[model samples]
Each structure stands twice: as structure tokens, then as C-alpha cells.
Target: MAPTPDEQSRTRTLEGVLWMLGSGLSFVAVNGIVRHLGTELPAAQGAFIRFAFGVLFLLPMLVQLLRRGLPAGTLGLFGLRGAVHTAAVICWFYAMARIPVAEVTAIGYLNPVLVTLGAALFFGERLAFRRIAAILVALVGALIVLRPGLRDLAPGHLAQLGAAAFFAGSYLFARRLSDLAGAGAIVGMLSLSVTIGLLPFALLVWVPVGPVPLAWLALVAAFATLGHYCMTRAFASAPLAVTQPVTFLQLVWATLLGALVFSEGVDPFVLLGGAVIIGAISFITWRESVLRRQRSSAVIQNG
Candidate 1:
């Protein structure tokens, strides 16, 4: 007999959780590779090459997007996202080269918190008390990780924070564009725009990169693409609440990778901070899910 709707929903949620796991692993691998590359090349150059390779990988989609005319007035939005994302990418690369993988991963968690704030500020979303409390908790988590006075704040930490902010900006733009275009078009345009945006920075700090670095960057592009695809799959399969908590496992994986492979010391502060940030984000996601369900039920009841 065919599975019931409830059973099917459970199965899809499980599938989405698994997809989130895969997405986390793929991104962790990409981070490991970038860490391995170290400071062998300028961060701008590294970011540019990575996104440039990303463009090549996304060539077919780009071609398709070009063939199908873009939605009106979206060109500027894509360009803006690309510009913001380029900054994020560069800062991320710089931070990855210098910071412990776990720390970088932990700091990056601020993106969602910033995005929540951005939505309220820019999109007129209601900033409820719970959201305000969550945002404050997230800020505390970030402070725990940095411990500005206790430990000398490294440029890497600052860079990662900047990356998170810029990434949030990019996400906000993507959110706007999502209402106007398909995912494929948004992704393809973003990739193309980032490549173009990074061109001058990459050129400004051009250095001869060996073939090995080029190959590794190509692999980075592939894994990054895979991660995005898996994340998209996860979102399609289940609500964000089901998949969001699974991302905390990325900190665990990153910590293990750092300890085992990079021989980096495991910092308890980083782990604790990461947990706090993840918990806050998870709470927000859960609250949103509950609110959404309540709204739907009210609509059904009234109808």
C-alpha cells in the first residue's frame, strides 16, 4: 500500500535533513581545501579564481538565462548582490587562510542573525520581542568567540565577521530577486556578476598561480556548487526548521577536521559560541514555522 500523507511528509523531512548533512559536508570540504591553500595567493585573487571557475561550471545555466530574457529591473539587483557577495568571498578566503576552520565556521553563523535584522530594517518585517532577544543572544555568542579583551582579536576574526555581514546583504538581495525570477536565473546571474565584480580586484593583485592551485580552486567551485544544490534540495523537501538545526553539525565536523587534519587546537569557546548562535537561529526558525502554521490554520478555519 502507498504511504499515507503524514508518512510521506515524515519521509521528506528525513530526506531534507540528510540533504542538509550532505550540504554541510560539501562546504566543510571546500573550507578544508581553502585552508590547505593557506596564504599561497592573495585572497582577492583566490576569491576571483574560485568564482571565475564557478562561472565556468555554471556556463550552461548562464547561457540558458541569457536565452530567456531577465525580469525587468532585476539586472541592477543581481549586480548589487554580486558586488556584496564578492566582498564576502574575499573576506572569507582571507579568514579561511588564517583562522581555525571551526572559528571561521562559527563566526559565519552570524549571517542569519544579521539577515533577520536586515529584513526588519529594510523589508518592514515585524521585529518581535523574541527576535530581538535572539539577536542579542547571537551578538553575545559572537563576543564569546572573539573575546575581544581576553584574546587579541585577529584580523581573521574581523574578516569573518565582515564576510557574514556582506553575505547577509547578498542574501537580502537574493530574497528580493526570488520574488521576480527563478532560482536558476538568480544563481546564474549572481555567479556572473561576482566574476565580473572580482575581475578588477583579481587583476589589481595578480600573481602567477601554479596549476595545482588552479586545480584546487576548480575543485572548490565544484564542491561549492554541490553544496548549494544540496541546500536547495533540502529546502524543497522540507521547511527550514527541519533542516536548520542540522547545520550545527557543521561546527562539529569543522572542529574535528581542524583537530585531526590541520592539527589546530580545539577551542571550547568557539564551540560554545557556535552552539549559542546555532541555538538562537534554530529558535528563530522554529518560531517562524509555528507562526506560519498558525496563519495557515486560521485561513483554513475562516474559509
Candidate 2:
């Protein structure tokens, strides 16, 4: 007999977890390559090349976007999102260049926290006491990583923080796009638009990139694209609550890679901070999922 729905759901959740794992590792590889190349090229130019190559993967969807175009307000939103995302990418490269890879990854855990805060602030969602506490705990974790008074603040840390903020903005636009268009259209427009937006900045600071760094940038594009594809697959297969927790492993992989490959010291504070932030975010995801299910069940019973 075929598996029951429960069994199928379990199977899908397992697959999604695996996909998330792959996505995390792939992104780790992409970050490593970006840092490696940052030494040789301008951050903006390198980011442009990476996204320019990333656009090649989205070409299959271009015809559809061109034929239908986007809804009236969405193109403007996409433009705004693209510009914000470009800034985020530039900051990311700059951060990766100056900071340890592990530190950059740890700081990046702030994105979801900022996203949740953004929803509360902009959408008039309730900022419940529990979530507020969670945010505070995560902030404490950030302090552990930064140790502001103990050490002088590095520009790289600030840059990564900025990237996290802008990335949250991009994600907000992504959520809006999901309601307005399909995934292909959303990704295609963002990729193509960001590539175009970066072109001018790249031209202004463009330095001749040899074949080696160009190839590395191509690898960066491939790994990041694949990581995103895996992330989408993971979500398609399972609930966000099911797959989101798996991302915590990324901090582990990034830390180890930084130590082994780059000879960077593993900071205890960063690890503890990343874990705390991941724990808070995971709780928020689980709590939201439970509330959503409860609402659905209530509606069904009332109907």
C-alpha cells in the first residue's frame, strides 16, 4: 500500500532538511570563494561579475517576464529591491574582505531578526513580549560577538551589519513579490535588475580581472545559485519551521572552513552568539507555524 499522508509529509520534511543542509554548505563555499577573490578585485566589480554570471541561469525565465512584464507597482518595487540588494551585495563583499569568514556568517544571522522586526514595525503586527525578549537575547548574542568596548569596531563588522539590514529590505520586497508574481519572475527580475544596477558602479571602478579570479567568480555564481535553488526546493518540500532550523549548521561549516582553510582562529564568542540567535529565530518560526495551523483548524471547524 502507498504511504499515508502523514508518512509522505514526514518523507518530504526529511528531504527538505537534507536540501537545507546542502544549501548551507553550498553557500559556505560561495562565501569562501568570494573572500578569496576580494583580495584581487574591487568589491563592487567582483559582486557585479558574480551577479552577472548568476543572470545566465535565469535566462530561461526571461522570455516569460518580458512577454507578461510585471504588474504596475511590482516593477517599481523590483527596481527598489534590486537597488537595495545591490548595496547589500557590495557591503557583503567588502565585509568578507576585511572580516573573518566566520564572523561575517555569524553577523549575518541578524537578517531574520531584522526581518521579523520589520514586519512588526511596518505591517502593524504585534510585537509580543516573548518575541521582544527573543530579540533582546539575540542582541545580547551580537554583543558577545562584537565586544564593542573591548575591541575597536571594525568597518567590516559594520559593513556586514549594513548588509544584513539591506538584505532584510530585499526580503521584504521578496515577500511582496510572492503575493504578486511567480517565483521565476521574482528571481529573474531581481537578478537581472541587480545586474543592471551594478553595471555603472562596476564600470567606474572596473579593474582588469584575470582569468583565474573570473573563474572563481563564476564558481561563486554557480554555488550561490545552486544554494538558492536548494533553499527553494527545501521550502517546497516542507514547512519553513521544518527546514529553517537546519540552517544553524551553516555556522558550524563556516567556522570550520575558516579555521581549516583560511587559518582563522575560531572565536568562542561568535559561536555562542550564533547559536543564541539561531535558537531565538527557530523559536519564532515554530511559534508562527503553530499559530498559523491553529487558525486554519479553527476556520475548518467553524465552517
Candidate 3:
């Protein structure tokens, strides 16, 4: 029997949650590799190589696009997204190099909150009171996690913060592109464009990479590509509001990885702050989803 709309929604949310869990695991693995590789590779080079090697995985997508001509002007948008995404990824690699995996993961959780503000500021979206209050809660959480005065700010922390912002920008563009392209196309553009964007910079400061490090970066690219594919599946299965909250699992996974693999001590404050931020974001997502459903029902009634 065909499921009712409510049942379908519930099923979709469940699928999204599972896909997000997969994405979290994939990203955690990537972070672990990036942390290890950071000791040997420059952040720029790691990022560039990740994308460059990632292109090999995305080859089928490239071939598909070539076989069927791309829509006019899409390449430019892809290029722009690639440039912005590369900046974020470089910062991420740098942060992973300097900070504990858990710390970087904690700071990274602020992406959705940043994306909300960016939408309001850059895209002129209306911000409701509840969303504004939720955002403030997230800000407080970020401060708690960072504890700027309590601990001297590390350059890696600052870089991770920038990474979160640029990641938000990349996400916004990816969301826009999703409307016009398939998941393969979006990922292909990102991999190809980011490689192109970083090539010149990589060429200037390039260092010889040993075989072991090269293999590590290849694994990073592989996991990252899988992570993105999972993310795309999650987003397609359910609304972002439903899936974004599940991504908080990355912090937990990162903390475990840091403790078990790197012998890094876990900070309670980071976990607490991440919890608060995730809680607030979850509420905001629920609120927005409710509003959307209500508006849809109202339109149905009026029609």
C-alpha cells in the first residue's frame, strides 16, 4: 500500500538521518587522515591534492557532462563555488594540522548557524524572532567552545572559524546548484573547480610528497568524496532542516577519534557547547519545518 504523506515524511527523515550518520563517519575518517597527513603536507598542497586526486573518482561524472553538454553559464557558477569551497577546505586542512580533531569538529558545527545569518544578510531572507534567539544561543555556544579569554586563541582556531564561514558559503552555492544539476554534476564541479582554483597556488609552494603521504591524501579524497555523496543523498531524501541536525554526530566521532588515536584529551566544555549549539539548531529546524507545513496546509485550505 502507498504510504500517506506523513508516513512518507517520517520515512524520509529516517533515511536522511541514516545517510547523515554515514556522512559523519566518512568525514570523521577524512579528518583523521587529514590530521595525520598535516604533519607532512602543507595545508594548501593537501587540499589541492585532495581535489586533484578526487577528480579521478569524479571522472565518470566529467565524462557524463562532456557527453551531454552542460547548461549555459553553469560552469561559471561551478567555478565560483569551487573557488569559495577551496578556501574553506584549505582552512579546514590547516586547522586539522594545528588543533585537536575534537576542537576543530566543535568549531565546525557552527556552519548551519552561519549559513542562517548569511542568508539573512546576503540573500535578504526574513529572520524570525525564534531563529534570531536560536542563533544567539549558537553564538554563546561557540564562545563557550572557544573560551577566547580563558585560553589564548590559536591560529588554527581562527582558521577553523574562517573555514566554518566559507563552508557556509560553499553550502549555499551547492544548495543553489542542486536545483539545476544532479549530485554527480555538483560534486564533479566542486572537485574539478577546486583543483583548478588551487593549482597555481599549489604549484608555487609545492613540496615533494612521499608515497605514504600520497596514499593518505588519496584516502582523504576518497572518504571526502563518499562523504559528499552521502550528504547529497541525505539532502535529497529529506529537507536540510531534518538532516543538518544529525551532522552534529561528527563532533562525537571526532572526539572519540582524537582520544583513541591521537591521545588528545577531551574537553568537557567543547562537548557541552556543541550540545547547546546542536540543540538550538535542532529547535530552529523543527520550528521552520512546522511553519512550512502550516503554510502549506493554509494554502491547501484556501485553494
Candidate 4:
């Protein structure tokens, strides 16, 4: 017998969760490797190399896209995304080199909330009261993590914040592009565009990197690409609400990895703040999902 609709939804959600888990692990590996690289390489050069390798890894897809050509109106969006994402990556690399992995990861949780707000502002999605509240709550969580009065906020913290905001912009662009292009095309274009965008900055900060670091960067490119692919699969498999909460595990993993591997002390404030931010993000996602279902039900009933 065929499975019920509810059962099918459950299966899809489970699959999404699993895919998100894989994405998180892939990112964890990427972060761990970047953390290990430390301040040995300039952030711009490091980001450029990673994305350059990303382009290499995506060569087949790029060639395929070149042969077929891109969809109309996608090139501009891809360029815009690349610009924002290049800034995000440089900031992230700088922060990763200077800060603890867990702190960087925790601070990055603000992206989803920012994305939600961006959707409302740019995509014309309704900004409900709950979303506004969630945004405020998430901001409070960010303050808790930073505790500006208690400790001097470092440049790394500021860089991570910029990275999160820039990343949110990049995500918004990707969401728009998703409607116009296939996943492979989107990913391939991103790698190519970011590599081009980063080229000038990398040239300005040119530094000789040994073969070992180059190899490690190639691995970073592979894992980061895999993470993006898995994340796309997860979104395709189920609603955002189903996969959003799973990201909380990334913080947990980052914390453990930081403590165990990097010998970084666990900061309770970061953990607490990360939890709070994740909770707000989860609430926003859940609310959106609920409203979406309600809208669908209303449409069906009216029909």
C-alpha cells in the first residue's frame, strides 16, 4: 500500500534532517581545517584560494553550464551574490583565524534572522509580529555573546558580524536565483563568480603559500562545496522549518571541536547566546511553516 501523506511528509522531513546533518559535518570539517591554518595566510589570499579551488572542483558543472548557457536575468544576480559572498568569506576567514571556532559559529547564527527580515523587505514576504519579536530576541542573544560592557569586543567579533550580515544577503540572492536556475548552475556560477571577485583582493595581499597549505585549501574547497550541495538537498527534501533546527547541532559540534581540538575554553555565554539565537531562528521558521500551511488550507477550502 502507498504511504499516507502524513507518512510521506515524515519521511521527507527525516531525509532533510539527515542531509542537514551531513551539511553541518562537512562545514565543521571545513571550519576545523581553516582554524588549523590560523594566521599563516592572509584572509583575502586564503578566501581566494579556497574559492579558486571551488571553481576547479566545479569545472565539469561550469563546462556543462557554458555549453547550455545560463537562464535569462541570472548572470546579474549571480554577480551580486558573488560580491556579497566574497566579502562574507573574507570576513569569515579573518574571524576564523583570530577567534575561537565556537564563537565564530555562535555569532554566525544571526544570519537566519537577518535572512528572514531580508525576505520581508526585499521579497515582499509578510513580516508578522512574531518575526519581529524573534529578531529582537536574537539581537539580545548577540549582545549576550558579545557582552560589550563586560569585555572589549574584538575585531574578530565585528568581522564575524559583518560576515553573517553579508552571508544573509548572499542567501537572499541565492533564494531569488533558485527560482530562475537549477542547483548545479547556481552553485557553479557562485564558485566562478566569487573566484573572479576575490582575485583583486588576493593579488593585493599576495603571499607565498607552501604546497601543504595549498592541498589543505583544496580539501577546504571540496568540503565546502559538499556542504552547500547537502544543504541544497536538505532544502529540496523538506520545508525550511524541518531543517533549520538541525543547525543547532552545528553549534554543539563546533563547541566540542573547539574545546577538544583547539584547546579553546568553553564560554558559557557563547553557548547560552547561541542557544537563544537558534531558538529564535527555530521559532521564526516554525511560524512561517505554520502560516504557510494555514494559507494553503485556506486556498484549498476556498477553492
TM-score of each: 0.98, 0.97, 0.92, 0.94
lDDT of 2 by residue, 68-169 (tens): 877777888899999999999999999998898888998999999999999888777898888898888888888888889999889999999999999999
Clash list (residue pairs), candidate 2: none
What is the C-alpha lDDT profile of model 3 across 57-130, one tens digit per residue?
A: 87887988878976676877888898898899889889999999988988888998999998898779899999
lDDT of model 4 at residue 72?
Answer: 92
Give the winner by lDDT: 1 or 3: 1
lDDT of 4 by residue, 1-303 (tens): 999999999999999999999999999999999999999999999999999998888798799899999999888899999999999999999999999999999999999889988998999988878889999999999998999999998999999999999999999999999899998898888889999999999999999899999999999999988898899899999898889989989988999999999999999999999999999999988887898899999999999
Candidate 4 colliding pairs? none
lDDT of 4 at 60: 86
**Highest lDDT among the candidates is held by which one?**
1
Q: Can you rank all candidates by TM-score, best first?
A: 1, 2, 4, 3
Q: List, residue by residue over 1-303, the lDDT tens digit for candidate 1.
A: 999999999999999999999999999999999999999999999999999999998899899889988999998898889999999999999999999999999999999999999999999999999999999999999999899989898899899999999999999999999999898999899889999998999999999999999999999999999999999999999999999989999999999999999999999999999999999999999999999999999999999
User: Candidate 2 — number of clashing residue pairs?
Assistant: 0
The local distance difference test score of each candidate is 0.95, 0.90, 0.89, 0.93
Give the top-scoring candidate (TM-score): 1
Number of clashes recorded per candidate:
0, 0, 0, 0
Candidate 1: misplaced stretches above 4 Å?
none
Candidate 2, position 40, lDDT: 82
As for TM-score, the candidate ahead, 2 or 4, is 2
lDDT of 3: 0.89
Question: Candidate order by lDDT, highest to lowest?
Answer: 1, 4, 2, 3
